[model samples]
Target: MAENDSFHHVLRGLGPQVEHRGEVIVIGLGRFGSSLGRTLVDMGHEVLGLDLDEQRVAEHSDSLTHVAEVDTTNVKALRQLGVGDATTVVVCIGADVESSVLTTAAVADLEVPNIWAKAMTEPHGRILARVGAHNVVFPEAEMGSRVAHLVTGGLLEYVALDDDFALVEMVAPDAIVGVPLGESNLRADHRVTIVCVKPSESGFTYADRDTVLDPSDIVVVAGHRSDLERFADR
Candidate 1:
């Protein structure tokens, strides 16, 4: 091609850097998806966000690489918006299973490299999985424990390292009292690592595994969600 032709070709694709940095298309600019888009943009990756609400799109204009108002139920409109070119397409729509299904199927039909769909229920998750979603995120169910913890004041903090991994801090319950860390075998049996132990009583040193668990000792642990839930129960 001639130089002028090449220059014109580049100009034609001038809107966003969808091809560079591995494009990510996030449908539904709701709370979860909006946060995800902002994080990706902050990381210097390209993100294209779509939502049915124009106000939501406008709200994220500063945080996302690109934002457009579109009804994801229309697969053709999704294609026109370049959903097919995305390296990863995430559907973050909640509550409406039909819209979620349509969007999930649209992305899959476009053959996006990865499709991640957020589900509100176990049945929703199974449906997304059946439609070839690379991963199904059950945000409500996954974070349900936090609500209980917050109400009871038993949890000091919650940090999600990833979809399945978490770091939690909680007051040690009566059951773990008098048990040494080494004997508890938290790492061996549950794959949970105790990063720190803060005793309710003063002048307590929790530097080694030989340290015995005391009532009301604040424990910080890193583990999978299930293991953490079980640990919290104990």
Candidate 2:
């Protein structure tokens, strides 16, 4: 077998045999984990954060519902801490690929319904998925791409719907101003869709045919990345 395949084969049985149960479990307490755990708490979901570091556990104790310094690599430690009961589990271990994979496998062994893991590279992400992670996120890579778009364009906000599709928020360009949106032919001329708009006086609302926009008005446009970039360049 290939070297990489052999490595995965050895990791396959690393998770301890354990039966199910947890609400929302977050493993690792680094920057990403802390941010994600706090956000989940802010959103009203109880999160159980597990980390091997005592200092980290103490640091985030107040931010999340529960924070513990438990060896996440051990299935018994996790189960004893109630991690097996998690309905949703997000492993945010960054840098340490071994712990990340092992912890994820352990979570998967528990048969958690939803598993989200953070991966630094494609290979790392693949291992995470192979170990049964339901979702894998590349936070740093995604953010880097997003920041690249922001720095290169006039976009106020950019959200990628997928590799090729994007939603952009930007100021009304001079070319599209001084006319009702319906008469502007933006769809035909710019090949973008105006889903919503925020005029100088109000909050964002669904844009309509009769919507007339002034310069500096914020507009939310959705389309392929290339089309949005081209329109933004205008």
Candidate 3:
């Protein structure tokens, strides 16, 4: 087997085992939070949902293990609802940044093991991270980035590693056809690595120096944003 194949084989042999069996608390009953809680329930996890709207609580009662009409930002209410000891708490209040921050901090003060929050902007995202949130998500901006990739037809998938770096996977344009990985020296020349070169018919083959590019092949590369932007014909 090739080196990359052996690497993937070893990774596949490792199992992802769940280490805890506690309830999950989800604050906010809006579109994002409600859907997330429902997915967790479908996965056989005990989910407790909290929202200020009584109507929402009633509407989703059947889908949740427990539902409460409580102001999630209120520390007393959050604690009374048993949110502090939840295995994980996800704060999905996007409409109000203050409320999201308050609830996220409340969960952290309560010592919840995992806290996930949604932020409205770059600053908000950074604040959430600094305040001890395990993960801060920018849903709107992220979706917009994905949409931009789709609009640019040559672009397949673009995953941001940081503000300036991205890993892009795309169908190699006609200009780069027939070039071998070694000759392109994507890593040395462009500071990008062609990790996976997947033919139209096969799933994927780990790219190597000798790997030849085909017109129908899809290449998954990790590198700076500038290189991928230029390669995508952007």
Top candidate (lDDT): 2
CA displacement after TM-score superposition, residue 119 of candidate 2 (Å): 0.3
Candidate 1 lDDT over 53-159, as tens digits, reads 98999999888988999988787998899887777888999878999988898888888766778888766766776675767777776578557655654567887
Q: What is the C-alpha RMSD of each candidate to the true structure, in Å?
A: 12.3, 5.8, 8.9
TM-score of each: 0.64, 0.89, 0.74
Displacement of residue 171 (Cα, Å) in model 3 is: 0.8
List model 3 lDDT by residue over 1-234, tens digit each: 775443332222221232455888888989988999999999999899898889999989999999989988787788888887676788889979888888888888887767778777766765665565777777787879877866865777877766567777888766557987788756665666778889988898898888888888999877777787776772
Better of 1 and 2 by TM-score: 2
Indicate whether candidate 2 or candidate 3 has the larger TM-score.
2
Query: Which 10-residue span in candidate 3 carries the lowest summed lDDT?
Result: 9-18
lDDT of each: 0.76, 0.85, 0.77
Superposed Cα deviation of residue 102, candidate 1 (Å)? 0.3
Superposition TM-score, candidate 3 onto the true structure:
0.74
